[model samples]
Structure formats: C-alpha cells, structure tokens
Target: MVPVTTTQIHSRPSLTIIGGGPGGYEAAMVAAKLGAAVTIVESKGMGGSAVLTDVVPSKTLIATADSMRRASGASGLGVELGDEPARADMRVANRRLLALASEQSNDIRRGLERSGVRIVIGQGRLVGPTTVEAVTESGTEIIESENVLIATGASPRELPTAVPDGERIFNWTQVYSLTEVPEHMIVVGSGVTGAEFASAYNQLGAKVSLVSSRDRVLPGEDPDAAVVLEEAFVEDGVNLVSKTRAESVERTADGVRVQLTGGRILEGSHCLVAVGGIPNTAGLGLEEAGVKLKDSGHIAVDGVSRTSVPGVYAAGDCTGVFALASVAAMQGRVAVAHLLGDAVKPFQPHLVTSNIFTSPEIATVGVTEEQVASGKYQADILKLDLSTNPRAKMQNVTRGFVKIFARKGSGTVIGGVVVAPRASELIYSLALAVSQRLHVDDLANTYTVYPSISGSISEAARRLHVHL
Candidate 1:
C-alpha cells in the first residue's frame, strides 16, 4: 500500500478528525479539498456504524425482505404460486451483507486518500483542543492540528440489569453477526431499530414478539405511521406487547428469558435489544479539552458544529442532533465550511429527514403532531391514507399514509411524514420543501403520476387548503 508522504503534508491550517465514520471521514474529505492538511484517526473500520453494522447491513437485509414480500404479493396479482414456501438462507444473506460492508469501507478509505487525507488506524483521544493522541497498533502518536473534529459516533445502549451477552441476548450491533437464524426472536424496545429487526425477522420466517414501552410500535414516529406498522406486524403474526418494558434478560439452556417491569415474562430463542445508543465520548479527554456536554453525555455544539472550546467541534450522533446519517454528513460538511472560511449555512435540525427501515419504511422530516402538541410547533397537519390509493391497492399494500404539517398561516411546510413502501425515498421531497421553506401550494401544484403512491402525497398537500 502506498503511504502518505511527508512532502505532501503542508504547514497550513491542519485538521484532525477522530473516529473516521461518515462525519469524521466526510469532514476530512471536505477539509482536504479546501487546502487544509487533514489527518483522520480511526479505531474501527471505515464507514462506521452506517456501513459495518447499522445502516448498510440493516438496509440490505430490508432489501432482501422487500424482495420476499414482493414475491409473496405476486400471487395476488394473478401470478402462479408454489405449494412450498420460499426459503431464506441467513448464511448466504449475511455473507452478502459483510461483503458489501467491506467494499463500501474500502471505497471510503480510497476516497479519503485520493482527496489528500492521511488516515491512521488507531483510537484517537483529544490531548487538547487542537491536539489528538492516537493509539495505533505500533505505538502512540500525538498530532497537533489547527482544528479538531470529534465523530466518535455511538454504541448500542445496554441496560445494566439486562445486558447483551452476544449469544442468546444480542445488541443491535451484534445481531448482524448471527449465521443461523433463530426460531423465535424477542425484540425488546419497539422503536426504530426494534421495529426494523422485528419486521425483517418476521418476514424471514422467525416467530417475533415485539416488546414496546409505549402504546404503539414506533412511539416516536408519526402516529399514522405507527398505527400502520402495528397493523402490519399483527397481520404478519408478530406478537405486539405494548407498554411493556424488559427489566432483565437471562440466557437459558434452550433459549432466553426476559423479565418485564410488571413481572411479566417473555421467552424466545434469542433477544435483540434496540433500546437506544450511548455516545462514544468516554475517555476522549472531552472534559479536559473544555468541551461542554449535554445532560445525556453527548457533546454540546452550536449551529456551526463548534463545541464550547475554540478549535474543537463535533458532529453526528455525538452531537445528538437528529441521530441520522444524512444529518451527520451535513453537519460534518457544515463544520468544515465554517472552519475553512467558506460560505456555510447554519445546521438546521428541522430540515433533516430520517427513516425507520421497517417493511413499509417510515420516514419523517421536520415537525410532527407530537411536536406540535408539545408546543414545539403550532402547525396544522394534513393526512392522506394509502387505502384509497390506486398504487397501494395494486401492490396489495393496505396500510400506511402520507401526512404533512405546515404553518397554519404561512403554509410553509414545517414537517411531513410518509409511511409506505419506499417512504424513505418519498420523504426527501418534503425535506427539500421544508429546507427551502416551500409552501403547501408548491406541493399541491406539483404534478404526480396517476395511480402512483406519490399522488397521495399531493392529495395530502391539497387538503391543507381546507384548514387554511
């Protein structure tokens, strides 16, 4: 492998990015391209959680599930069906996931190199506001830079009472390591991660029991979207336990047993914990560097991604903005632009779109009813169900809807939600509209193909006039 040469290194404003995930690596790329000598320190492989264990692998698995669902729907479209059910090979599917993750990681590393960024495989800690100490396999090296970016990302949140053993009980990051599929999988925490895995495993023929601490599957998502997923999970024979919290999990000889807060018990062949994540901020010298941390232990940053300390900034989940990869990348770019004296827009948390990778994925951008109810926004909401949509009926997808929230007087699209197949893709248009401060009139005026799922989106926008 060709190493970065000393001659190529410059004495200009130097940037050192710690963690080398989407945020770190992307910041390194931006800083390098902007004539800043950049160095990235990475403990794990490139692409971070988005590639190795979280986004890429989970989405790829969802893709396989999608294909299976489509094939099942083929019979409804008058296609022939076989008496035997289709089979999914977990080993083959996992092999493909790993291969894709590796390829993407390599591509990210190569891109950083081509952009004139130096990458060192090590765990980086902040020695000061502008100095990073990297512990590599060879030894430790302290690098001084003009600016530092922390993108250490996060790890799966585990409960002390019910920890993941990585065998019978697994965390979200460890679930992908499975070669053989479990016969019965109990998913604790019915949030985004839990819903996605439950949906995938249910589709893959696993007996799934989804445990939720809230009244619905996706408590934090759009209300209509949550309802749709709850119905879908029920139709697929997924046992939905609402308002139930797993107090503890223990590995049994035959499988696993989970004790609930209310003294209820759930037994399954395996348990996957998807409660949440904790930022990878410990022992990073953050406190010593004078960076302020939030109550939840996430680094506090301004709109420009700058921490309390000058010359030090943070992005991605470490900042706890939206916890979305897209938002993380944008924040990283925003940090670079601001530091490099380039024209930059302040990071807007409201405009970031996020998706939960369930069967009929749920994607939302901007505000929600809960936000409005809680006085976060006083916007009016318009909802359109997919049951009346031609494409949804044709596809045999009976559940899901499109909902949009806009300022009552201005009609500016403050927020929107989509809960249908490819909802992740559909939420982008709304994200753009919200980011650009577009109004309902713009969405209503836009043309959508007849008999398309997106037509419902337009209809939802059109209905906004009634409230106005």
Candidate 2:
C-alpha cells in the first residue's frame, strides 16, 4: 500500500462508500473534500478492475505492442534496426504490465488516504438504508453513515459452454497471467474489449482471429469508423469471422478449439471470451435495503446516481450507465455532491466521450450518425480524411479521418468522430464544442497548430459553416 499524509481532524458529516473502484474512491474523495467523514470498503485491491485487471493492464500491454509495431514500421521513415529484428518477450512484458497495474492501484489508494478517507479491506453489504456490514479477515464490523454508496462494480460475463480455465481458455481478466505470448489467439465477441485486444495481439505478432456476432466489428460504434478498422484488421492479417458467435470452447491436446455457430471450428493456442459484463450486485443486501435493480441485475439509478432507497446511491459498472471509467468518476462525484448538500448536476451521458484504443483508435462524442438517421435530430455531417492532413503525411499515417456533425441551420456542433493514431486526444475539442453547444463557426474561428491532426477539426468546421 502507498503511504499518504494525514491532515488535522475535523468533525464532518459521515459517508460510507462500498467498493473502492473509480466510482467508490472518487466519491469518497469528493465527500471528504466537502467536509464529510468518508469510509471506503473494498474486498479486492484499490482501483478495482480499471487498474488491477481490465483497463490499466490491458492498455499497458497494448502500449508495449504499439511501440513494437511502431519500431517495425521505422524502415518506412528511413530508420534502420541493424540486421536482426526486434522481438517482444511476452513473459517480461506481462510482468511489467502487472507491476504497472499494481502501482496505479496503490497510487489511487494513497490519493484517497491523503484526502482523509478511511480505507477498509473487506467485503461490504448494505444492512440497512444508512448502515453497512463489512466482513473482513479480522471479523465482522458494522458502520453507521448518513449516506451510503454502492459501487461494487462488475465482472466479465462467462458462457456456460465456454467457461474459462484461466490457461488455454481465458476471460478478459485472466489473459494477463499467460507466461508466453499465444502463437495464435481466437478472440470471441466484437464489442469494444474484444476489438481492442484482438487488434493489440495481432500487432504484437500473434496469429489473431476475431469472431463477431454482428455484421462488423464494433457494432455499437460509428459504421464508417468500423469499416476502416475492419479493413485494417484484414490488411494486418487478422482473420475476421463476421456474423458468427462462438458456441463453445474446449481444450485440445496442445491448444484450444472454438466451435462457432455455423459448425466452423477455429483452432488456436488460446481463446479469449469478451462477451460482456455482469453486475456484482448479488448477496450485497441491496434488495433487502430497498434498492431497486434492473432485470439484468444492475442497480437502477437516476441521473444524479440516486437509487430507489434514499441516502443510498450507486454508480460505475454496477449501475450499467455508460461503463467508461470517466463516466463512473463523474457519476460518483455527482452522487457525493447531492448527498453533501453541494450544488449538483445530474449525469448527462450525452456529454461524455468514449474511446477504443486500437491501432488506429476510434473516439466519439455527443450525437452519432445513427441518432441522426433515426430522425431524432436534423444535422449536417462533414468528413475530412487524415491523409489530406500534412501532419498525417509526415507521420506516415495513411488511415483515418475527422467527421463533424452540426445542426443544419443553426450550425451548432452536436457531435463528431475521429479515427487516427491519437484520436483519443483529438476528440476533446469536439467534446467541448458539443457539451457547450458551440456552433461550427465557433470551432472554425479557433486557431489550430500548423501541420497537426487537430487542424482537420477546424477545417471540417469551416466547411460545415459554409453550408450553414
């Protein structure tokens, strides 16, 4: 555990947070800052899956693979790598990735402690509206609070026929324990997690196959962005099996065999299942405490993160309202503000931004093309390919584009998408415009650095402004 500096004590309103993931810890900090005495109960390590297993570990692995892929392409930039080529040591990479995950988790714990939030290593349940029962290795402890927050988070959903053995068969969380890079990896499911891992491993030099139950990868994302990624996946030697689902996964003599819905079998060194996630709400005494839950087992909460029971709120994956970590943090903060008598704004998910960290990352903010086609809003759309950007040419980036959507007559920027190497970073300006209801002319007037991918944003805005 990381050490933190303790401050002088002061009497404050009491608040308790169950689960120390982004949602729990973030809310704890907010409540503490607002002069609330905060206690966080967590069964696993701090930072939850976002740090210990799912987000941090996976992104760290992808970063290593991304660097290797960049080095392999250095020849195009007139860079030489001697006679021998670069190779990644999977054992060392996995070890470093796990270390980084642990370090980040500790950092989060320290930050919370520094904010005067008490951390408890235990499993917490809602015994009453404002009471919590924590069971630790030491013993059962009861805590009383004016407010309670449930953020137990979620776990990877597993299919009965494709249960993970944690060796040849794995879930998104278990893949980090592999001692060697899989010679071939079959990734089932085409959601954000599946697409990202599939693309990362493929670039990491694994023979990768992506099985999608939908017509294309990333069925929930922009169709144009998906098309670019699917093309790139195939060009990079990834066998994409579309409109197919994995029926079952069984270990063979040396590897694993994945049977698809159509009787097709894919043999690989390992199989990773990324179907979805199941909320961790059972046995937590939520129902007994009068907290309503959806049929899917997720806590039912309003925009301000309020549950059916007053003084008891929920956030993060457990609420099933936008699984992104950023959204979770915001939801947590909102819940704390409402509980602590601070001015609070209900969570507006439409203002949130989401990203997929694949080779050519895909990012979007606000309204989507699907929403437009659904006739919910009338908007003009514009797209500018990165190939036309001078910065992209200099960086040898041949794929991706910047797309913007604006109201037809008003020219207000409603939403946008970016597909490029650093689309995650480039989507912020568009996010700001959409959130603030800034018009296309507002973005068009903004000055962008020369020879940068961001220039495409302003350029697209200029074109949209002309039509308006």
Scored by CA lDDT, what does every candidate get? 0.87, 0.91
Best by lDDT: 2
Runs in model 2 deviating more than 4 A are 1-11
Query: Considering every candidate listed, which one attains the maximal TM-score?
Result: 2
What is candidate 2's local distance difference test score? 0.91
Put down candidate 1 lDDT per residue, 15-96, tens digits, no spaces: 8899778898888888989999998988878888778888888888878778778877788889876887777788888889
Give the runs in model 1 whose Cα sits over 4 Å from its true position.
1-10, 466-468
Give Cα distance to truth, residue 327, candidate 1, Å: 1.5
Over the stretch 359-379, how does candidate 2's per-residue lDDT look in tens digits?
Answer: 899999999999999999899
Candidate 1 collision pairs: none
